[model samples]
Each structure stands twice: as C-alpha cells, then as structure tokens.
Target: MPRNPATTTRDALLAAAREEFAEHGIAGARVDRIAARAGVNKERIYGHFGNKEKLFDAVIKDALDEFAAVNTVLEDDPVAYVGEAFDRYREHPDLLRLLMWEALHHRSAALPDQSWRAERCGRKVRSLAARLGEEPSPDVGRAVLSLLGLAMMPLAMPQLAELLGAKMDTPESVAAMREHVMGFARAALEGRASASG
Candidate 1:
C-alpha cells in the first residue's frame, strides 16, 4: 500500500526534530534547521505541530513511546530488565539527552504528556511488583525508578562515568556497568522485600 505523504513528511520532520532537540535542546534548537534537515518548508512545522515547543513535545513523546515499547520490565528477572534497558540506552544515547533537555526546558512546570508518562510509570511499577511476587507498592515503584536511573546514569554522565573508570563507548564497560546496576538493584529490592516481610 502507498504510504500517506502527510505521514511521510511528519516522520521526516520528527526524525529531524529528534536530532535537533538532542543536540541543542528546545531553547537552542532552530526551526529553520529542522525544516532544512527534513527537506520540508518551515511552515509545515507550524502547520502540523502548531509551534516549536509542540514539535519538541511530539519528538519527546515519540522517543519515549519507542523506549517503552522496547524495554518492558521482565516478570521474573528485574536485573535482565535493567540490562536490556541499559543496552537500549547505550544504543540510543540521544533519548537520555532529550530527556535531560526536557527537564531543563520545563523545570518545575508541568511537562508535555506528563499524565501519560505517569501512567506508563505506574504500569512499570506494577510489572516490577509482579516480578517480585508482591503487590504494587511505593517500595516497588522506588526500586523500578532507581533501576531506571541506574541504567541511565552512564549515558547521562559520560564524563563522570569515564572519570570513575567506566569506558562509556565499549561493550565490555557497558556490560560491567549493567552487572553493577543489576546487583545494586537486586540488593536494594531484596532488602526492601525482607524488611517488609
């Protein structure tokens, strides 16, 4: 079937916007550059997304949706879940950059798709709870959030990871980081479970 031209253009614009936002963030990204990279007229961006901020929101939503789809929490092994999430982030470091940019741009204000993101987080907490054979509680939520933070730390602070003797670009270093993250998460969650029991 022939693809819709509108969809094709939207995809192109999103791809261009992702790169721009990751590199320069919302405040620094230029609409003209996004249009030029997308090979579309600048007006199309406003027409399709209303404005630059909206376009940035769309880009973030797309990136996060892709991440959620690929990195589901495992029911039996949280470590494996963290390992997979770490690998995905290693492959797509831009997602972390984009997230950092969003935090910088939005600050304390309500973020775009905040409710949807919260709902997704809730689902992850439930998944983690099921994995641990426990009810979804604040403890499980914290563990899930902590594990995600651990997975993101290396990419989010490449310089720090490197200064701390982590080779951010090599597979072996990433594997070692993953092992540490899994062990840390396992110990914390196990301790929490034992305390509660």
Candidate 2:
C-alpha cells in the first residue's frame, strides 16, 4: 500500500526534528532547517504541529512514548528489565540526547504536559514496586529512577563513562556493564525489600 503523503511528511519532519533537537535543543532548533532536512515546505511544520514549541513537544512525547512502550518491569526477572532498558538506550542513543537537550533548555521551567508525564512516571514506579514486592512509595520511586539512570548513563555520557573506565563504544563492555547494572539493581531492590520487611 502506498503511504499517505501527509503521514510521510510528518514522519520526515519528526526524524529531522529529532536530529535537530538532539543536536541543538528546542530553543536552538530551526524550522527552516528541519523542513529542508525533511524535504517538505516550511509551512507544513506549522500546518502539522502549530509552531516550533509544539513541534518540539510532539517530538519529545513521541520519543518517550516509544521508549515506554518497549521497556517494562518484569516481576519474575527484574534484571531483565534493567538489561532491556540499557539495550533500548544503546539502540536509540538519540532519545537520551534529545531528553538531555530538553532538560538543559527547560532548566527552571516546568516541562510541557507535566501532569501527563508525571502520571506515566508514576505508573512505571508502581510497576517497578510490584516487581520488587513492594507498594509504590518514595523508596520505590527512587529505585525506579536510579535503575533508569544507571541504564542510560553510559550512552548518555560516553565521555564520563570512558573516563570512569567503561569502554562505552565496545559491545563487550556495554554487555558487561548491562550485567553489572542488572545485578546491582537487583541487589539494591532486594536489600530495600528486606529493610522494609
């Protein structure tokens, strides 16, 4: 089946926007450049996304939604959850860069759709808590956040990882780090559960 031109254009715009935003951030991204890279007219950006800020929000929402869809916490094998997250970040490094750019640009201001994002985060924390045999609480939330941060660290900051003795560019090193993170997360969660019990 032939693809719809509008959908094709939208996808291209999004791809171009991801690269731009990942490299330059929201404030620095240019609609003209995005359009040129996407091979679509500049007006299509406004027609599709309303404006630059809205387009940025759409880009980030799509990236995060995709990430959330692919990664899940497993009750039986929690280590696999962390391993899968690390793999996801390895495969989609741009997402981390885009998120980092968003954080840098939105330093003091609240992010767009804060309530929706928070609700999604709450769900993940609850899921992680369930896997750890605990109810959702501040500790569970912190654990969830820590595990995710650990998974993303090597990809998000290759230079730092390298400086700290991790070979961020090597598949073997990444696999080893993934195993270590999974073991570390498992122990931490188990320790927390024991402490609470």
Candidate 3:
C-alpha cells in the first residue's frame, strides 16, 4: 500500500539524511540509521528514496538550492553578493562541511540525476559577467572560485587555516574573515574602480 502523503515523515527523513551524510559520508551512512532517526521503518527509506546514494544526492541538492536562494539575491552586484554569500555560508556551516567531508573521503557515489553544482557555477559566471558589462574574464571565474574556496577551504582545513594564522569556525572570526575576503574580492572584481568611490 502507498503511504499517505500528508505526513511530515518525508521531510523528517530528508533532514535526518542530511545530518547523517554530513557526519558519516556516503559509505559510513546507513539507511537503517537514517530511517531510525526519521522515525520511519528502514524499508521506508528504500520505498521513498530508492537507495542511499539517491538520498545523499537529494540532501546535497537541497542544500545547494537553499544556499543559492539566499546568496544569489544581489544579481546586479555580484561583488556585493559575495559578502551575502559568505554570510549565508557562515550561517549554514554544516552544508559546506558536508560537501568537504564528501570530497575528502572521495565518496564518488553518483549524486542523483542533478548537477546543481555546475548549474550554480554557471549562474555565478553569468552574474559576474553581467556585473562587468561584458562576458566575465577568466579572472572572474578564478575570483568566484577563489571566493567559494576561501569561504569553504578554511572550514575544511581548520587546523591548516589556523596554522596559517587564519582562525575560522568561531562566530566572530568567521564574520571578520568574510568581511576581509569580500573586500579583497570586490577589489579584484572592480580593479579599476576609484579607491575614493
């Protein structure tokens, strides 16, 4: 029999899966545990998501979508958007960490049928191009990549960032770092802008 669609159980499962995959990575995550956390039967996970990899993919896509919704608001000013992007990432530290964990562990499981990652990059490229009144230069791509990298790499390598004297993970430190990096990024994006302006 088909389960009723009115319950919040699906939402619960996705949330639990996000936390689990964020912590455990693909190989470490277990459907039974996700189901248990969601208060659903283990079989229900299979019934709903079809498999573990799909569940993780859904979680990642959802996270990316949520991040984009917040960070991509100032389309006319991507340099300013970078600050907001940093703020969004700071508020949702786990999402970046989860992506990092997946990368570090080399979990190559296919992330569903969606490639929101590439789509997001493309959107950034277009946004950067629009801000510059022309196609974005190679530097723009590099800057956007660096902006994301700077935002994420610190958290991904806390000890290393700390070793380099860039303390991350603290609320205040992260905010300061975001401001500093955004300033640098804005300068790079608008290199010829009058300093007085």
Backbone clash numbers for all candidates listed:
0, 0, 0
- For lDDT, the strongest prediction is 1
lDDT of 2: 0.84
TM-score of each: 0.91, 0.90, 0.80
Per-residue lDDT tens digits of candidate 3, residues 17-97?
998988788888888889899988888777877888778777877887788786354347655677777677677877886
Which ten residues in a row are the worst by lDDT in model 3? 188-197
Q: Is candidate 2 or candidate 3 better by TM-score?
A: 2
Descending-lDDT candidate ranking: 1, 2, 3
Instruction: Give the winner by lDDT: 2 or 3.
Output: 2
lDDT of 2 by residue, 65-100 (tens): 888866455554667778888888888888888888
Worst 10 residues of 1 by lDDT: 69-78
lDDT of 1 by residue, 24-84 (tens): 9999999999999999999999989999999999999999987886644556677777778
Evaluate all candidate structures by whole-model CA lDDT and list the values in order. Answer: 0.86, 0.84, 0.73
Candidate 3 clash pair list: none
RMSD over all Cα atoms, model 2: 1.9
